[model samples]
Target: MKLQDSVIAITGGGQGLGRAMAEYLAARGARLALIDLVPEKLEAAAEACKAAGGDARAYTCNVAREADVEATFASIIEDFGQLNGVINNAGILRDGLMIKARDGEISKRMTLAEWQAVIDVNMTGVFLCGREAATKMIENGDKGVIINISSISRAGNMGQSNYSAAKAGVAALVPVWAKELSRYGIRAMGIAPGFIETEMTASMKPEALEKMSAGIPLKRMGKPEEIASAAAFIIENDYMSGRMIEVDGALRL
Candidate 1:
């Protein structure tokens, strides 16, 4: 798909990587539908996209809710007239080990709420948004792309049982959607990002960030623009479906 004049919808577009991607793609001449929960952040991100050299509109949405996703995508298509792509980028982190024990004795276990919260936002939200985007794209006869933002933690990370599980689920959907949507000229892909310089990671302690960065082969965290560049490449390349592009500076979980 060409970036020029393309209509791309992004979840979690209020800030961080989602906003970075919106600006990156917008600069390439694509129109954007920026979706997020915060009205103020969405408006700011939309304005930023417009300032980046393309048109953009803000839509407040809760991607985890089916009704919100359906309505948001419909509105995107209604407003843009043609849907070209969507990025399932909305996610939440509920970090905790499933079981916390001292000396093999019972201590604390991850609550159901912790697990469910992450699953609802990260995994279920991806499914809901992907379904709505595909439906809209098919109805409009647009050859579009769906990019799911997975994570290196999908490989399984300590202290992140819920996050890892949700990430893994989204990663698995890439090939499934690619095969299922191929007939309609729609492509599906995943991006498993390692630690990056986002608001979430930026809030970590300096020593924690330094230690984490040292573990990566590149000895530094990735930039949001780096991930955004990978997303842009996926949208621009026609035959790059059913696979994930990891932008982790060669880091592995």
Candidate 2:
């Protein structure tokens, strides 16, 4: 699909990968509806997109909430007159081991709250946003694309039972949504990035970051723009769907 003048909705558009994608898409002439939980961040992102020469608007919405997702999409359609695509980029990390013991004594374990929180945002949030986007597109008879953000941790990482499970589910949704939405001329795809240089990874200690990068074949973290480029490719390539593009610099863990 041509991105010029197309209306694209991006969740978690305030920062990191989402912000990069919004700016990239905006530069390509796509109108944007940037969604985020923080109003200030949403405003800032929208401004940046506008500066990139695209019509952009900001909406504060929690992707994990059904009401918020539905309402936000409705508002987007109302504002843009049509919704052409959606990027399910909103996610959170609550990494922890399932169990932890010290010297034969139980110390701690991953709490149900941590597990549920990650699942709610990473997994359920995608479902809610994708469903609403598909519904709107089918109703309007608009051929569209849905890009979901998965992670290298989907392959399973230690100390991230919750995050790993949620990301794995995200990867699975690509093929399932593709098959289910093909009849509507809507394509579903995923991008699983590994150790991207985003705010999430910036919090790591310097030594830890160095060690992580050393393990990757590229010996460095990926830039957010690289992942944004993948999204653009999927959006423009009419035949691409039902698969994931890994932008992890050949990192496997």
Residue by residue across 97-128, what tens digits does model 2's lDDT show?
79999988989999999999999999999999
Give the runs in model 2 whose Cα sits over 4 Å from its true position.
Answer: none
Worst 10 residues of 1 by lDDT: 244-253
Please write out the lDDT profile of model 1 over residues 1-253, one tens digit for every residue.
7899999999999999999999999999999999999999999999999999999999999988899988998898889899989999999987877898898897889999999999999999999999999998899888899999999999999999999999999999999999999999999999999988999988999999999999999999999999999999999999999998888988973
| lDDT values for all models | 0.94, 0.93
User: TM-score per candidate, in order?
Assistant: 0.98, 0.98
TM-score of 2: 0.98
What's model 2's overall lDDT? 0.93
